[model samples]
Target: MSAPASAAAQDGVDRLTYAPMVMADLDAVFAIEQAVYPHPWTRGNFVDSLASGYSAWTLHDGDALAGYFLLMLAVDEAHLLNVAVAGARQGQGIGRYLLDKVAACARGLGAESVLLEVRPSNLRALDVYRRYGFAEIGRRKNYYPAHNGQREEAIVMRFVL
Candidate 1:
């Protein structure tokens, strides 16, 4: 599917486009994921997510892959499973763009809220979520596998649509 290009970037000059994720985009997606995370999701994980009917979309800046996000609609809520902006594109508000896009998708799907779990250690993401109006609802203990072979707690956050 095709999503119309978004209005100019925050700078008011660049244009962005959105498209449904395809297998062909996996290589780039994996590369960005691998670069951004200490423990990245394998290609198989992405494949399975697609096969399970999750909604995934990629954002592009001209011909370059800028970022991507995944949304899973369940009952009346939508879950934000993954959102990653290319290393080079991080800190440019692309992540925030993806968050807004997915939340709009959730609303279109008849969802009342958008829920996501972020590692407590992911300070960057925590800050973004907070700025995006996601409130911490609860925590999942030992929910994330840490690099030290130990588990880290996950902070469950939600944005009521």
Candidate 2:
């Protein structure tokens, strides 16, 4: 069964519920990824991340997948691998909710910070990260593949947990 439409369209102040991702969520998650990103992650990548023990969670509103996030915990930090909200759900607080959840989880795991890479061109995402107290620390050259065989730089940002 899919998520209820009413849940997906909850009012701005409603709290979101997050749950562990199951294999059945891949199809919906992949659809959102493709809709929201230029260069989307492949199914194998998601599978590998899951298989490798990455912490993966999906935001749900009564069985509907609103969004998902993946993070990897290291000795003293947590690396945010991927985060996306369904196309129709952007600009809602879902992204912030996901980030907040990750931050709490990182703190619980004794991580000092949370780190993530964002495409330099993604101003919206950058703003979201900044609002959450993430500051740019460095850049990785040619980190993300671009459309015409060129490459885009990735801004590395970190937030204290």
User: What are the Cα lDDT values of the candidates?
Assistant: 0.87, 0.87
Residue range 1-161, candidate 1, lDDT tens digits: 64334433464224778899989999988988899987789999999998898999998777778999889999999999999988887777788888889988999889999999999888998998999999999999998889779999899999999
Candidate RMSDs in order? 5.4, 4.9
Q: What is the lDDT of residue 97 in candidate 1?
A: 83
Clashes of each: 0, 2
Return the TM-score for candidate 1, rounded to 2 decimals: 0.91
lDDT of 2 by residue, 56-155 (tens): 8998767567899998999999999999988777876788888888898788778899999999899999999999899999999999999889999999
TM-scores of all models? 0.91, 0.90
Model number with the top lDDT: 1
For model 2, what is the alpha-carbon lDDT of residue 78?
95
Worst 10 residues of 1 by lDDT: 4-13
